[model samples]
Target: MFKHAIAAVLLASANVAAPAVAQPAPAPSTAQAPLQLWRLDCGEFVIKQYGAFFSDTFQYPRGPKNIVGSCYLIRHGDRYMLWDTGLTDALVGNTFDNAAQTLRLRQSLVDQLRQIGVRPEQIELIGISHWHFDHTGQAGRFPQARLLMGRDDVELLRGTPSPDQDSTDALAHWLNGPGQIQQVSGDHDVFGDGRVVMLTTPGHTPAHYALLVRLASGPVLLTGDLYHFTEQVANRGVPPFNHNRADTLASMDRFDRIARNLGARVIIQHEPADIAKLPAFPQAAQ
Candidate 1:
């Protein structure tokens, strides 16, 4: 159901006696250039219960229940970063059935990324919105990239038996890879220009996060499960199963304050309506 042989990194034992070769070194990622943002459809889930997404705060609001899994790509000069990889590419043909949600893929994430001329290896860094399986689906595809995740999430993944069955067992390989994991203390600036910043928006998990990419057109805030529904943005619906209810509400408050202050378009990653915030695939926002 998918083409994964070329996922990235095929290592082999070295031939120390092999002849010396000359090759051109890849250019550094510091070259200044305008940023380009591309949105990709990773997968979608069928939500049967409105109560499933929120706790006591939710009142069975009327709206569509289906939610999308959004994966984002950011190109800064020669540097590339992937934010919140959707459901695993291996799950392309299969269905994810569990207590939290049931996800089915429209297309593999790598295939969508390839449509825009980005190979897995081209991604210099992978920013995990949090350690949830839905967001870290293809993390194993880019083991070469430095994985920037919240310290609390790192701890979450380290414990036995993942919180959600939606995760890929192979993702553990990527997380445990040598020198690939970079546990962030809090917010991290991907570039020195402060254009791409990772905000620590915990509560959804112990230390969930949101990505803020400042493009020439405008600032875009990719809310990572801070609010699954657009109505949550207004009603402040806190998921019942979230790690900490107080923390979830606090995180929502901070998220709203930042969105209002930046005058940025807040994209509820699951809500399909927010897809219009960026140009369709093959065309970038900036």
Candidate 2:
């Protein structure tokens, strides 16, 4: 009986040792690929004054101001990616003009791309910060480009009704077309590394996102309406017109932390001052 008990104890010991012996080693963390950031001027896209609420203020210093629109050109190896599409010709009607003085409205996105020698067909990916009509107006131009959008934004785009009712028919058609659409639920590593990451920051919209680009100049955070201007970031102000005030504040806090941690430069999409600071595309010539 004693011998049998000893045998059983040995068998249990062997079983424990087997697992330790078979345990696999941990995989190494992936190294981030090198990346370059290019600031593409999509001519001048206009934004109606008070079109976007900045903090508690609905109107700008100058009543009903129109602002220039700028998009990004991100180059990853052989492929080129567009951060957002600018205004479409459809937006040039009297209604848009009457809303605010034309601060700056230039050529269409297609025309701008042509001027830069980049065809719409050459664009591999179009990553939208949100589903706003102004930002997404020219998305349909690149029918073959893969559309990357936040998952929550996708639901909001796919006929999910919101009281805002700011949806554009052209945007809806573009999202539902034959082109491939990739939905990201949370923070995404675009290059399977930390180089170009898409962080989910919901506030202005349920699916608002920010892009973090690890550039040679250092890290750069492309804030898409999270804070319309630097003053919003400075004051930690939440815009009056947001889906959720609390969520918006929290998102701002996150942006602060990220910018500090990465020592990144935060670029506000609509802020004219922020746009003026950055070096334009074709960096060598500039």
Candidate 3:
């Protein structure tokens, strides 16, 4: 039915005749620039009892769950923007091991970027999902880039004795001086053309954000710890450590509506399954 309807529209358009009057030459086109997106592996962690970490109400079945960490590289025209920094480079060789969790990075983010011919210096903007260690770990490596993060999350980092010492230390350059930083209060159109946007969700953290990348293939939504796993989306599971329960629920509602309205391909950042939505590393989604 859909194909036939499209065919009918094409047939009707083909039947139209050109105007008899001569028209002036058209000016140079000013269409929106094209975009490209690439997903890179930052790290992975395994929780002994994933249910306890991702839910406040025992929503998920008790068992080990390996959560993957990811970082994204976006190219808008000639400029490049990086989303999230993932785990620290220090984790490349050593692993953070404990009874509750084990975290490690298989490769440094810079190394992965190099594999795809992107250098840390080439990235002009770094948009962070939130002020979490796992996400801000390697931000310092890109000191030349302007950092974009939630306003509240920036304030948290500015405060004395930050809650997450690792993140605070990693982002010290942005907090103190030298490095540029932009504290985002609401949804931010990164490139000003609306092709890329940072959706302010703010439940997992005070200023958490989900990224929306408009690719030629489709609109892709990157969930920033909004739903750790697919099951969380079904049960509306809120992590016990989330900043606000009510805010989380509201953000989830907004996220869902945006995804449905845009018919976006939603990729839960930490979910291994969602990570496979895009082409493998080194290949971009254009």
Q: Each model's C-alpha lDDT?
A: 0.77, 0.67, 0.86
Q: 1-286 in candidate 2: lDDT tens per residue?
A: 0000112222336447553333343322223344666665543534444535344644334335334566787777667788877655555432344443343335566766676678888989888888776677677778888888888777777764643244445455445666788887778777654567788888788888889887766778888778766666767766565777777788888988999987888888777778766786545111
**Taking the tens digit of each residue's C-alpha lDDT, what string does model 3 give over 159-225?**
8878888999899899887899998888887877667889989888999999988887889999988
C-alpha root-mean-square deviation, candidate 1: 12.0
Candidate 1 weakest ten by summed lDDT: 1-10
For model 2, the stretches where C-alpha displacement exceeds 4 angstroms are 1-34, 42-53, 57-66, 90-95, 100-104, 160-168, 284-286
lDDT of 2 at 233: 76
Range of the 10 consecutive residues with the lowest summed lDDT in candidate 3: 1-10
The segments of candidate 3 whose C-alpha lies over 4 angstroms from its true place after superposition are: 1-31
> TM-score, each model?
0.83, 0.78, 0.88
Per-residue lDDT of 1-286 in model 1, one digit per residue for the tens?
A: 0000213333445765554454543422323587988888878887766674564656665333787888888999889988888788877888878765677987876788778778888989888887777888887778778888888878777777766545535456655547477788777877756778888888888888888888877789999888887778777777676787888888888888888998988888888899767788879887
